[model samples]
Structures are given as structure tokens and as C-alpha cells.
Target: MHVPDWLDAARQRELLEACRRWARPPAGLRTVRTPGGGTMTARQVCLGWHWYPYAYARTVADGDGAPVKPFPAWLGELGRRAVTDALGPEAAREAAYDIALINFYDADARMGLHRDADEKSAAPVVSLSLGDTCVFRFGNTETRTRPWTDVELRSGDLFVFGGPSRFAYHGVPRVHAGTAPGDELGLTGRLNVTLRVSGLPGPAPGGGRSGPRA
Candidate 1:
């Protein structure tokens, strides 16, 4: 429930710049209505010294297991700091989160209610918002039925869900247009990078996970 505005403009710029450099639009970057009745477009760009997913020597844009955004280690560390600041270092045990799916949302883009269950690890997922804003819908674990919470997600804000809320059903129902940083940054869309440690056993091998792949 803690949203940190601690990431200053400079830090935010640093994150956005790094993300752009490693941007890789997934094969499905085009507009499509998801099962949850919302439209969305996204690209998966890998980050770090290695390209990711593949984890080969050179970081290439095309390959398996490639990261969507290679945010600097320092930035990830900052996310841990935010977690620690909010929930303490004990909760920051997994500071070295390595995979993220950078989701780009246009004006009409929307995401249906779902859960982040791809990763084997139940560690917290740190989501950073850049450009634009939308209604982030969160629901309970039982089913996508009634009883839910609507939280507005803005630029430069962070949302971490672990512990009891880790497997909570969540999604984006609406995205306001022209809410992201423009061409000056060489980007004109809403970017959301969610960092996590993946490749673990969950509900099932390829079952009900609700996040994009590496």
C-alpha cells in the first residue's frame, strides 16, 4: 500500500533512458483485446550485462529468455531500498530481481483482472510506472468475482505486492492518453516495468500465470 515518490526526476530519467536502450517489442506489440476485455500493447526488452532469458555472453534483442528492460543494478537496488524502507530489509532478501516485462499502454489500452504467477519465486514484484496513468484494479485470490479495489497508478510511482498480496488478482482497466513522456525522451507511451525472479514451479508448469514472459 506504500507508493514512493522518492525516485527523483533525475533518477526517473535514468530509469527511462536505460529502459529505452534495451527496449525490445515482443512479437505481440500490436493492439489486441485481452481475455479480460481490455486492449494493450507491449514489448519485452532485456537489461543488464547479459541479454537475458538466453543469458548468453552478448545481450541481443532477439532470443529466448531475453529481458524486456535492462534497468541498471543500481536501479534494482533502489527498488530494494524502497521495499526495505517500507517493509524492512528482511523483506528485501531478494534484491537481485532479474526479469521484467515492460508493458506499453496507449490511450485505449487496458488489462483484465489477473495475477502475477509465472515466477516460481513468491518474492515481491516491484512495478514502476512511467508516463500516463490508469486505474489499477486489484481483486481477491479466490476468483475474479465481486469485491475489488481500484487504485490509480501515476508516473514515477512504485507498487510492490508480496507476502499476503503477492498472488492477488490485479489488472489495468483504463489508461488515459498523452500521460507519458514524449519524443523529447524518444518515447511517447506508458511504460510499466515489473521486476521479478522467475523460472520456478508454481500452480502448474504453464497454467494460470498472468504476466508477460522474459
Candidate 2:
């Protein structure tokens, strides 16, 4: 479901600013290379759990190998509120959003049809969009082909999918360049922040465990 203008101007500004900081150095924004040799046009950064082509890790094993930035509590709270607004209070109260994947899309960037199956949890995925609008295709789990809905997601839009739709196939087919929110937001391309639960064991205090390989 799409909740248009779910985030007010002030909230949008705040998140955008936070994203700028999160996109810098160490565990910062970087291109994602698929195992197949092609690279994703959109650059991304992960929090809580680092994401590679097909799995999640505690560190960016594919990048600088630094530990990922911790997921902010404030962002988790915001996600809970979003779940309550989009799903219900029960889901909001139960959501344990510990991971965030922030994808940056330029004009020519597009995500292929895919399902977010790396997460072990069955919880819903909450996506918050900022900057330019894009055609977000929501498809079925069985295949990447037809019977999908193309939703035009603009800045401040919130989309939450759970239940049967939780594992559905989805992707961004196109982004309308130069359509970012006014300069006051300080965002150029599109920024997509998706919050999820890792469902994996948490690291012991002082880092007692290593993430399993893919």
C-alpha cells in the first residue's frame, strides 16, 4: 500500500539530511556488483546488517570490510509509526526493524524484478522514498512477469507490504529525472530507505560471532 505524503516537510528534510551523513565514507554508499558480473547503476549503503547480492552480513565484506553503521533507534521508531499508519497498531508494536537498505538512484538507474528473500523474518518491508519519483512495480512471488502494479512513488511516500505481498517480486523500472523535491530538501536523485528485520542471531557483546557465508 502507498501512503502519499506520509512524511511532512520537516520530517523529509530530517531524513534526507541523515541520509547524506550515512552516505559518507567507511560503510558509505558504493556500487553493488551482482555475482553475474553486471553492476547495479544505483549505489547503496546498509545499516544494522550489510547486504550483498544475495545475503546479509555484519560487515561490508564486499567493500571496505568495516562494520556497518548501527541502525538508529529513531529510524526504527519512525518505521514503527509507518507500519501503524500503513498496516495497524498491532503490527507497529510487533515490528522489530533492525536493518535498513538505502538505495540511491540516478536518472538512468533501475532495479530489476526481484524478491527480497534474503531476510529470514516474515515481517513486512517498509519503504520510504525521497527525491525524484519512480515507477515502482509490484509483482507476484512466482515470477517476474506481468500482473504487476506500477505505482508512481514520489518524495515522502511510504509503502508497506506484508503477508502475501511481503515476499512478492518488486523493482523500480524508471525514475523521472529532475523531479526531486525542491532544493530545500537538498536531495538530487532518489533515495529509497527500506527497513527490515534481519531475523538472524545478534552479535554477542564485544563481537563473539561471525556471520555465516552465503
Candidate 3:
């Protein structure tokens, strides 16, 4: 589902400012290195849980080794509202949406077609786009080839995929640089914040983390 202009200018600026802060040091934005040893062009930062290639970790296992930033309750709330608006209240359950992957894309950056299959939860992915426009390719679950729909996602646009499309393959093939109202939003590239339910085991009773820190 797509919702255009979901966030007004003020809200877009607010999110841009937040992304600027989140791109700071410690467990901040950095290029992702896949387990296959190839580095991804887009930079990324994580909240609630650190995403390292094909798995989740509490710290940047592939980078600075800092503990990831905590997931903001308000961000999760925004995702809930997006899901409710896109998929309806019946589809928006009180799932503990904990993972947020924010990616920065320049004009040359392109993400290969892939599936959001690492997380255990079947919850929908709530994606919010800010800054420049991009070609978002939504593909099937079985393959990453043709038979996909390419959607033009602009600033303040919201895209939520769930239900039968929860594990579908999707990616950003190209970013239209300078398409953003950079003078106002203070962003030249594209910013995508994807909210998901990690579904990893919760914290133990003693304030310790549960599940494998893989």
C-alpha cells in the first residue's frame, strides 16, 4: 500500500533532523558489508536491534561494536498508525515493532532485490520515504527477477507491505538525486526508514537479553 504526502513539510523536516542526529558516531550510519564480503553502497543505521547482513545483533558486530540506539516509542507508534491507515485496524495488531533500519541513498546507490526474511515475525514492514525520489521495486517471494512493480516513492510517502507480501522481495533500484526540496528538508539524498517486528525473544526477567545474539 502507498500513501502519498502522508507527512507534511514540517513533519518531513522533523524526520530529516532526526535522521541527521541518528547518523552520528558510535553505532551510527555506515556501509553494510554482506557476509559474502561485498560492501553495500547505501549507508545504514539501526534502532532497537543492530542488523548485520543476514542476522540481528545487539551491537555493531560488523562495525564500531557499539550497542545500537534504542527504538523510539514514538517511531513505533507512527508505524502503527501507518499500518492502521494502510492495512486497516484489523491488520494492525499490537505487535512489538522493535527494528528500524534507516538507509541513506545517493544518486548512484542502488539496493539489489532482496527479501526481508531475517526477522521471525510476519508483521508488515512500514516504510517511510524522505528526501529525494526513488524507484522502489516490489517483487514476488519466489524470485528477484521480472514480474515486479516499480513504484516512484517521493518525500513523505509511506509504503507498507504485509499479509501475502510480508516476505516479498523488494528493493530500490535507483534514486533521483536533487529531486528533494533540499533547501527546506536539508537532505540531498533519499532516506528510507523501514520499521519491522524483530520477533526475537524479549529480554529475560532479570533485565538481560534473551535469544542468540547472532
Per-residue alpha-carbon lDDT of candidate 1 for residues 1-214, written as tens digits (9 for 90 to 100): 5485645566667767756644535322223333466543444443432222223222333444233333345555666776776667898886566555667776766677777775557778788888787788878887887688888777777788778988989888888777655643344667787776654332111212221221
State residue 92's C-alpha deviation in candidate 2, in Å: 2.3
TM-score of each: 0.71, 0.93, 0.93
lDDT of 2 by residue, 4-91 (tens): 9998777888888888888998999999999999999989999889999899888888899998888877777778888899999877
Model 2: how far is 189 from its true place, Å? 0.8
Residue 203 CA error for candidate 1 (Å)?
23
Off by over 4 Å in 3: 203-214
Query: How high is the lDDT of residue 86 in model 1?
Result: 60
User: Roughly what TM-score does model 2 have, to 2 decimal places?
Assistant: 0.93
Q: How much does candidate 1 score in TM-score?
A: 0.71
lDDT score for residue 67 of model 3: 85
For candidate 3, give the lDDT. 0.86
Candidate 1: residue 162 Cα off by (Å): 0.7
